[model samples]
Target: MGNRLDRDQVVGTALELLNDVGLEGLTLRRIGKELDVQAPALYWHFKNKQDLLDAMATEMLRRMNALQEREQEAEGGSGTGTWQETLAGSHRTLRRVLLAYRDGAKVYSGTRFTDTSYAIPMERFLAPLVRDGFTPGEAARAFYTVYCFTIGYVIEEQSAADDPGRGVKGIDVAERAERLAEFPLAAAAGAELFGDADAGFEAGVAAIVAGIAATRERGRKVN
Candidate 1:
């Protein structure tokens, strides 16, 4: 049996099957069937579904890192950006990667990383922020703030995007406008909230960055 599969191979198979069976339906036994092996084989690599999930999230992080590396290479390395831009851009790539797979954002969120694959790139982005006056803790919080924003946004985005495929209802702006017409402000807000996803995401990033910057300035005054 091909039970001698490595961790990455196991994770790759799981992600491939993720699109078809989706997160809830994915299983080690199902993956073994696909690999033509006994379920024990997968256990050699993953002791539990959560273990497998952590590895899968790490693999996703690796993919995000690889894309950033390529972008740096294309720009002749040591790619330039302010700390805010750098942080925002990292999560933007994360959003793209998460959106690439069915329930990808769901798979990623709340899953722990199995390795230090995120360390290097995370360090790269955190450096400028730390040097610019934010403490390591503050910088980490900022990164996480944007990271959570990206994940939450993509989760909603995926839900909305998936509705049509499964004949489900989604964020129908026109319908919302009509239903909430009694409250003109609430009705009009739908156009901004769900109308232009790209713009909405950027606006969120900008607002978060601005908040971080404001906190940093306040800290400077206190010091």
Candidate 2:
């Protein structure tokens, strides 16, 4: 009498509900209601909330991978760029996807993907570094550095934008100014320091990529 509910369908609906209710409000019952399915049906697909969240996180990564593919296709499929550009592009794409959903970084941070499907995307990110003369361990570390930075950046960015008081140390502009008054340079630069989140993210990522490249170059010369 009704369309069959599947794992993909469930996860898709959960992501939709995530945007509406945020991670804190996202629950199986809410997703089931969104799908017009009974709790038992949802249970058949996911044993618990964590299972469903993992699926959602996996789906988020899938979407990020799809976006990168589209970007490469638009750029004539070669994906030609320096290692820094490639890594920055991937990190930026992740930030975009995480910001698309409400509390997406929070959801993704909590998930542990056990699916083999994640391997392809993981390799897509890591392979470039390895090919650029990074050891496998170095490539993994580099990728993790960028990945962790993006996640942490988005979590703070979203929190600051959504709930100002919930952000880092709850320091508002006035409070920051007050706290830094004793330090002239810090007081003068407080606004600039906290002024543009996007600029800060870009600057930080660029610095990290450049640092990694410089380190690798030094290693090559030393060897």
Candidate 3:
């Protein structure tokens, strides 16, 4: 047990263990054991489990931002696209990052970022919206509207993928469909609602972007 263990090393190891133990079972003590350090040693870097989780979330964002940058570079450059494009792209990349790890949405939900690296992407995301006439507050609101949707969507998505009996699948689609056979739409909606995760997520994001765009036009009318 060296006295010089750094935060990144600890966080990195914790992430390594996450897919196996998940957030609930991912204790600081467990991480310490995995790192071959004492639990108290971890406190030098993080105050507690929540603090460590925040750090984990920050690391997740770093990875997500990296993926976004690489994708942007492959496409051309990092220039911000239309507000809708940027917003939609942000959700797509974010979902991929979260789904990459088990209980990732749990680790991400309600965790404050431990660093300022998020500012760069936030700046790039907000710039186009600002140029398109969403006041800073409105732009921020619009971003969160979509951002929250993505996080929540991934949460359910991961939950369902991990355990099919949970999430929307908890409902007995066949039984309900049989009971509601008299109603054509009710009988058929279950498969459509629960099927095609990719198409469903993209459709929801598209709807949110349309709403945000509508707000920009409404603000113009007000001004």
Clashes of each: 0, 0, 0
| Residue-level error in angstroms, candidate 3, position 133 | 1.6
Question: If scored against the real structure, what TM-score would every candidate get?
Answer: 0.90, 0.86, 0.88
How would you encode candidate 1's per-residue C-alpha lDDT over 97-214 as one tens digit per residue?
A: 9977888999998899987888988898898788776789988999999989998988877775546332112577888889998999999998888777778888899999999898
Error of 2 at 185 (Å): 4.0
| Candidate order, TM-score descending | 1, 3, 2
Indicate the TM-score of model 2. 0.86
Identify the candidate with maximal TM-score: 1
For 94-123, candidate 2 gives per-residue lDDT tens digits of 999998998888989968885877787777
Model 3 CA deviation exceeding 4 Å by range:
1-5, 164-185
Candidate 1 weakest ten by summed lDDT: 160-169
